[model samples]
Target chain A: MTDKTSAKVWENVPSPFCGIASDDLRIEVCGSSVRVLANGDAVTVPGFERPVTDTAPRIAGEPASLEDAVRRAAEILKEARLPVFSGFGTDVNDTRAALALIDKVRGIFDQARAAGGVRNLLALADSGWIATTLAEVKNRVEVLLVFGSDVEAAFPRFFERFVWNRETLFGQDPARREVICVGRAPSGDAAVSPDGRRPQVVECDPRHLPELAAALSALARGASLQAETVGGIPVVVLRGIVERLRRSSYSVVTWVAGQLDFAHADLTVQQVCQMVALLNKETRAAVLPLGGQDGDRTASQVCAWLTGYPTRVSFARGFPEYDPYLNDASRLLKDGEADALVWVSSLSPAPPPAAEVPTVVIGRSGMQFDEEPEVYIPVGVPGIDHAGHMYRCDNVVAMPLYALRDCGLTTAAAVLAAIEQSL
Target chain B: MTALSFTLKSPLRQRLDASPLVPDRLLGKSPKEIATLDLQYGNRRIAAADLFDIAGDDAESVRISGSPKLDFAGRGMTRGSLIIDGDAGAYVGMHMKGGRLCVSGSAGLYAACELKGGIVEICGNAGDLLGSALPGNKKGMSEGVVIVRGDAGDRVGDHMRRGSILIEGNAGMYLGARMTAGTIAVRGRIGACAGYAMKRGTLLVYGSPVSIGATFNDCGLHTLGFLPLLLKGYQGLNTCFSETRACRSRVRRLVGDLSVQGKGEILLVA
Candidate 1:
C-alpha cells in the first residue's frame, strides 16, 4: 500500500536514450550514453551508435574519405623516413581518449626512426641499468637531470606521480630528488625537484650544444678554461654540475626533445655519456634515456623476446630477421622493398601507413583499418577499457592500468597470445 | 653489398685485434689465425680459440661459428660472415662497408658504425645503434641496413644520414632524430618522435602516433600510389592492405614540417 502507484513510476524510468532527463540538448553527443528527456515525456532506449558526422575540432574533410587521409599521412611520414602505425579511424570521439597512447607512440617512432632515436630514450633503456620507477626516482634517486623533454608536455603527471606524491615510495612525507635542467629555452619550467635539491638550469640555444659538450668534456678531464659561458652555462654552474655528476652514486641523464637526433643532440649525448663514463670510473653512474611515449618498451620487449632484435624485422622467409636499413617500413614502402607488411597498432592515435601496407588493429578503441586488415581485432584500453599494466617512459616502474570503462574487450596480452598461437 | 665467407678452426694464441679503421685486418686475416685469435674481454685478455670452439669457417667472407657475443669478433670486418650463435659484444663491426654480420642472437650496442655499405643482421636482438655512427661523429647508420630480429636497446640509429633501421618489435624513443636521410621502421609500435627534425627522410609507422612534434605539416588525404603493392609482401601482422567491398575509408597525405622548411612527411592510415 505504501508504493503501489509509485512502484510503476520507478518501473517506467526507461533507458537513457529514451528517458528524458528534462534537459534535451545535454544528451546530444550522438554516441555517448547520456540521460535523455524529450518534451516532458520519458522514453527508454539503449545501445548508442552512429556514423561519424564531422571530426571538425580534430580533423577536416576535403571531399574525401578519412581513410585516404590516413594513408596519405602514412606516405608523408614514410617519405619523411618516419615511423607510422595503422589504427586510425574517423572516430574522433575515441581519438581524444587515445591522445596519450598516440602521443607516446608518435614520439617514440619518430625519435627512434628519426635521427634522434637513441638519445630520445633508447640508450638508457638499453643500458638496462638506469630505468627506475617514478617512486624510486623521487624517493631514492638523489640526482636527476632534466635534459630536453618537458615532463609537463611529454608526461604530464611526471612530477605528481613520481616526485610530489605523498603516498608514494617516498612515503607521505615529501622527499624530492635534486634536479638539474638543460635546454635551449624555458628548460627549467616544468619541474625543479620538490626536495631541497634545487635544479641547476643550463639554458642554451639549440645550436651551441657542441661548445657545451666540449666544455663539459674539458671540465670532466679536469681541464681549466677561462670561458665564463659554455653551452650557455656559466662557469660557476658548470663547476657545480661537474661536482654533482662526479659525486652522485646513482643519477639519470634525461634526453628528450630530439637530443641526439637533432643537429646538436649528438654533442649533448656525447657530453652526457662522457660524464657518465667518467662517473663510472668513480662509482655507479647511470644515464636514463627517455623512451618516447607509447608502449614502446612493451613492443620492444615482446618482439625482442619473440624475435631477436627490435624494429624492421623480416618474416618473409618464414623466419624473423632484423634488417635496419632495408626492412625499415618507410624505406620498404618508398623503395618497394618489403613485399608485404604486418602493421601493428596498439590503439595508437594515428592511422597506419598510406603505402598500402597490410595492417592489423590490436587496441580497445574499436577501430578498423582503412584497408580491410587481414585480422581486425579490438583490445581494451590498458587503464580504462581493460585492466593491465604498462611501463613508464623509463621502462622502470610497472604501472598497472585499472579498468575504468565497462567495455567488454581483451587486453594486448590476450591479443598477443592469440596472434602468437595463430602465427 | 658483396657477401663473403671465411672459416676459423681454433681461437688464436694471442689476441687478434681488428682495428676499426682497417677492414682488411679482420677481413684479410686467414681462418686458421682468426679461430685462435683472442682479446681482452674486460680486463682479462682471453683467447678467441677458448671462447668459441670454431666451426664451419667461410674464409672469403670471414664467416665464424659460435655466437655473436664475442666482442669485436668482426670489429671492422668488411665482406665477411661473422655469425655468432649467441650474442655479440660491443663494437662488433665499428665501420663495416660492403659486407654482412649475421648474429643468431643479440648484439651489444654500437654494432656497426660509419657504415658506407653493408648488412648487419641479428637473428635475435641487438643493443644500441647497431649500424649507427659512434659518438663525436656526424653520421649514424650512414649507408646500410642494421636489422635486429629482436628488440634493440637504445640509440639504434642516433643520426642516420642515409640508411634504414628495421625493427621487428618496438624501438626505443628518438629513433630518427635529425636524420638527413633514412628510414626507421618497426613492425610493431614505435616510441616518440620517430622522426624528429628530419632534414629529409621517411619514418613509416605501422602503429599510431603517441606524440607528434610541432613540426611536420598535414597534407590532404589521398589513396597513395604505393601502399597496396608493398602491403602484399608483409605478413608480420598477418594483415593485408587493399580496398575491398567492405573498405570505405580514404588516406591522408601531409607534407612539410614547416619547422625547418623540412620536407619530412608523416602518414596516418585511416
Candidate 2:
C-alpha cells in the first residue's frame, strides 16, 4: 500500500447515482481523475469521474455568456402560452429553483422518472403502508423478498453495501440472511452471501405479483388455497417461503415500482403493500419500494412542499392544480398541450426530449444534443460543482451531496434562479 | 398586545416566501430591524420594507393586508396570532406549533399543513392537502384544529395523524385519506373516497356523499347519543357549525380500510 499518510484522500463522499446513497466511499484524487478506495465499484467510477468534463453555455448553438443565455431562455419561456419543465435530474435546491421558474411561466412540472413517481404517490394516497430506513434494513433485515424486479440490475451496489455487508453492527450473520427473488432470475447465476452461501430464487411471471401477493397474504392469515399451484409457483414452495419469513426475526419486501410492466401498475404495488401489512400481524415485516432515479423523489418532495402535490402539476391556471393522468409529460407532449419545454439534467448527460417544440436544455457539460435546442446552458454537477441534498429511495431520510471541486460552472439552481429573475 | 400590520403597495411580480417574518422574529425588534427583515422573492432576496408599508407594533397579533403573492405566512411559529386580510398564498401556517392563524380571503395549497398544535381558520376557500403531511412525511397535523368556512380542494387532511378538520362547504376527493387518527367533518357535499385507507380516524359528513372507497364496510344507520356532545365541542368555534346540534338524527356508520388495518370509521349524518 502506498504510504497511508502521504496520499491525498477524501472520506465519506456520498454518491448521488443510486437510491442507496451510500456515504462510505473513500476517494483518492489524482489530478483530474479519482480512484475510489473503499467500497468503490463500476457504478461509482463513472458516477464520480464523469462530471469533471468541460461544459459551456450557448444561445442558438453559439457559445454565449451565462447571463445572456439565461436572459434568452427567460424570454423564450415568457413568450410561451404552455410550457413543460421535465427531466429534473439534479439536487433538492435545483428542483426548488426550477419550481419557481415553473410557477412564473405557468408551466407543467414533471421528472424523467414521472411514471414511477405517479405510481408511488398514488399508492400512498390510495393506501398508507409501513416503511423502514436503509440503516434498519442493513443492520436488522433477516429476509428480503424482491418482487417483480431484479434489484441488483437497478441498484448495483445494494448487496455489497447493505444485504451482504460484512461489518453489520447487529449480530445477525450475513451468511444466514435470506434473499428471495421472485418473478425474475438473480442477475449473477447465483447470489453469494458474504460467507459464501447461495439463496434460492423463485421463477414466476412478473405480472402475477399481485395474485401471488394476495395468495401469500391469505396463506399467512391461515387460509387454505384450493389450487395446488398459484401464479405458476407450487403452493408448497410458497408455503416453505412463508415459513422462512415467519421464522425470521424481521422481513422486508422490496420492489422497484418503475420496473413494473403493467399500466396503472400501482395496483400491483397495492398488493405488495397488502402482503407486508398481513405479514406484520404474524411477524415484523415492512415494504421497501425503491425508485429514486434522476432525483424523482427530490422533485416530488419540493413540489409537495410548495404546491401540496406531486408531479403532473400545472400552474397555468395561476393556481397550482395536480392531475396525475391529465398533465403527464408524455401525454402533454403527444397531445400538444405543452407548446414549449425546459429540460434540466445536470447529474447525467442525457439527451433532451424529442418534442416538436421550442426546447431549452440545461444539462451537464459533456451532454450531446441530437438537434440543437433554442438555448443550452451547461451547469455543474451536484456532487462536483456544488454541495446539495437528495432524498434516499426509502424516503425516510435525505443525504448531502458534497462538492469535491469548483469547475467554474454555475449550478442548475443558479441558472434557473437567474432565469426566474429575468422573467 | 398591539397590532402590527403590513399593507402591500402593489401586487407581487413573483412568489415571495415570507417564512422568516413570523411574530417571534418581529416581537422584540425595532421598526428598522423589522423593516430590514429578509424575504425570498422567487429566487431573489428582498427586505420586508421593500414589498409592503409597515405600521403598528403589536407582537401578539399581526395582520397583512392587500393581495401580494405571499406564502408561508406563519411557518414554524410557536406563539401569537397571524391574520391575513386578503388572499394568502400556499403553505399558510405550515408546520405551526402553536397560536392562531386566520385568513379572511382564499388561502392557497397546503394551508395549515402538518400542524402540531393551535388553530387555523380560513373564511374563504382553501386549496389542496389542507392539514396534510409534507411529501414523504408520514404524519400530518398530529394535534390541532382547522376550520374552513368555504369550499376546500382535494385530499384535505390527507395522511393526518391526530387533529380535527372542519369544512363548511363542499370538499373534493380523498378527504382524510390514510389518516391514522383524526376527525374530519365536512358540513357540505363531499367528493369520492372519504376516509380511504384510514387506519383509525373519524370522518363525519353532514351532506350527501359521492362515494366511499371499496375497502369500507357499511355498519348501518343508527342514532348515536354522542352526536350532541361532539356538536357541543364546536359551539362557539364558527357560525357554520352552530347547527351541528341538529345532527343528532340517525347516521350511517361505516368501518373500514379492510386492505390494511380496517379500524377506521366514517359516519354520514342523515
Candidate 3:
C-alpha cells in the first residue's frame, strides 16, 4: 500500500460493475486499495471496494509466471478437439480479444449471463421490438410499467437517477410520473413518488406472466375476454392499467430478463413486446429490457458488431455459425462435447462452472474454485486496475472506465492476447 | 442400385457438418473424390475418409450411420433422398427445398428449420423449434410435410407460413406458436399455451391439452366435415392418426388468439 497522503480522489468516475454504468461516483484510491467516497449504493460500493488478492498466475495450484500460464492455457486448448470460451464477464476490449482468440481456436463463445439475454434475443429474433435507452426513460417517459422485476434490487439507483429526477426537457413534473408494477411488486419505496404516491402493484405468480401479458395485449387491442380473472388479476384491473398506458403520451414497459426464470420465458417477452407494439399504433410506447450486469451487454454488442449474431456463436466450421440452443456452453460441457473450457471473468470474483474437461480460468484475482483448474491467471478488474469500455444495459452507450490504481495485475485482454499469440 | 453409405468409424469427438454428404452435392463425384471431400470436424477440416467408411455408389440415395454429433445432415437438398440411421444433431433438414430426409433416431433442436418443400420424417423424439423459422427469418417451413413418430419439444410450428407437421407423440409448450398458416396434429398430450399469438392455423389434438391460453375462446363442440378429409391425408403415412378408428369428425373447436389475428383454431377431438 502507498502512503495515506498519496490518496487521489476521483470525481465523476463511471462504474463498470453496475448494469446502468453509474457515472457520478466519487472514489479515493491509495495504491491498490480503493474506496467509494460518495454516491455509492449496495451494488456499486462493494464493487468499487473489492480488495485485490492473488496477483500471481497459478498452474494447477502451483505458482507460475505469466508466460508459463498463457503457454499452458494455449497448449491445453490446442490439444482439445472442441473448446468452449465461457464466462465472458469482461469489458469491450477484453471481449473482442476473447472472440479473436476463440475464432482462431475454432471454439464456442458464450457469456455467463447469456441464458438471460437469450430470452430477449429469442423474442427479438422472432418479432423485433422497439426499445428505448436511459435518456428516453429519464426525459420522456410519463408512464413506467414494470413486469415481474424488482427494479431496485438489481438496479439500486434506477428510480433515483432516472424516474425521480429533478427536471425534464419536456417540462413534465417528475413527481407526476405514474409507476405500475405487474406480477412482482417492489420491495422498497424507490418507486413511490416524491408526493407520497405509491406505485400501483398488481401482484401475481411470475409464472403466469405470459398469460397476463397476453391479456393486457388483448385488452389494449379492444378484445373482450370471457374469463373474469386472468393470472389471478381481475380483468377490470388490467383494463384500468391498459387505459392508463393508452392515455399516457410516452409509456415505457421494462423487465429484467433474469428474473423471468420459467421455461420458454421468451414467449412472455414476445407477448410484452407485442403489447408495446400495439400500444405504439395510437401512442408512443417501447420496451426496455434491462440486465447487463457482468458485461453481458458489452460482450453481446461487441460480438454482434464483429459477428452478425450475438452470443452462442461457434467458429468450428471455419466461419461464424450461430445457434443459440446448439451452442449453449453449459449443455456442451454437460454433454461432454467440449474437451476444454476457457472461462473469462474479470469484473467479479464469480468462479467458473465446475467442468470435467481441462479448464483455463482468467478471472478476478479472488475467485475461488471448487477444484483447481488446469490453468488459472489472476486478472485486473476493468475499472479498478485498467481502463476499458463497457456497454450499459440500454446497449446505446458504452461508458469509459477509468483506472484508479496502478495495480500490478494485468487486464483480461492482455492475458487473452498472450494466449492467442501462443496458439 | 445400392444407396451410397457412410458408416461412422467411431463416436465423433467433435460435431461434423454432414451437409456436404447430401446427394445433389455429391452426385457425380468419384469414390476417390468423395473420400477426399473435406468435412468440418470442430476447428479442423478433415477428409471424409478419416471419419467415415464410404461405400456403395448410388448417389441419388445416400445413407449415413448417424451420431448425435452429425449436424446439418441434409441441408438445402433439392433432390434425391438422405437417411440417417441413428440420432442426428441440430438442423437435420435445414432449408431443404425438395427431397426426402429421414432420421431413424432422435434429432436435436431446430430440426427441419426453414424447410421450403420436402418430406422430413424423424422416427424418434425431436428437439425444440421442430419446424420453426431460422433466427430472424419471418417464414418457417413454408411448404413441407414433417412426421415425428415421437414427442416434439416446444414451439413446434413457430412462424410457419404453410406446412403440415404430424406428431404421433406428445408436444411441449407453445404448439403452433406465432404460426401464420399451417396444420399441426398431435396424437398425444400437449403442453401449455397452444396456438399462442397464432394468426391462422389449425392445431388438432387427440389428447387433452395441459392448459389453454386465456385469449382462446371455446366455441363448444362441433361435427366438422373437414376433420375426416384432414385425417385421410395422412392415411398412407406410418402415423397412428391414419388409423380408421381415429378419424372422428366430432371435435371441440376453440378460436384464438384474440391477442393477435384471432383466426387460428384448436380442434380437440371428442
Sort by DockQ, top down from the best:
3, 2, 1
Q: How much is the lDDT of residue A154 in candidate 1?
A: 43
Cα RMSD (angstroms) for every candidate in the order listed: 21.3, 11.2, 1.8
Winner of 1 and 2 under lDDT: 2
Where is model 1 more than 4 Å wrong at Cα? A1-132, A141-143, A165-178, A186-189, A192-199, A225-229, A232-236, A247-251, A257-270, A280-285, A316-319, A323-326, A339-341, A358-379, A408-423, B1-270
The digit string of per-residue lDDT tens for model 2 on A1-423 reads 223334467898887777678788887755445567887655556767664555678887998888899889988888776788888888899999998989888888988888886777777776668887778888989998888787777777777777877757878777678888877777872356766677678877765564565456556655555556756788788878878888777998888878875654564576577767777877898889888766777778888898988788888766787767556777667756577889998886776778888889888887788898888998887876679998877775788998766557789999999999988
What TM-score is obtained for chain B in each of the predicted models?
Answer: 0.71, 0.95, 0.97
Best by lDDT: 3
- List, residue by residue over B29-119, the lDDT tens digit for candidate 1: 6656665564543113445565544444335444444333244656556664556555555566666676677677777657776666677
TM-score of each: 0.45, 0.61, 0.97
For this target, which candidate reaches the highest DockQ against the unseen true structure? 3
Give candidate 1's fnat, 2 decimals. 0.00
Lowest-lDDT window of 10 residues in candidate 2 chain A? Answer: A1-10
lDDT of 2 at B173: 70
In model 3, the clashing pairs are: none
For residue B2, give model 1's deviation from the true position in Å. 19
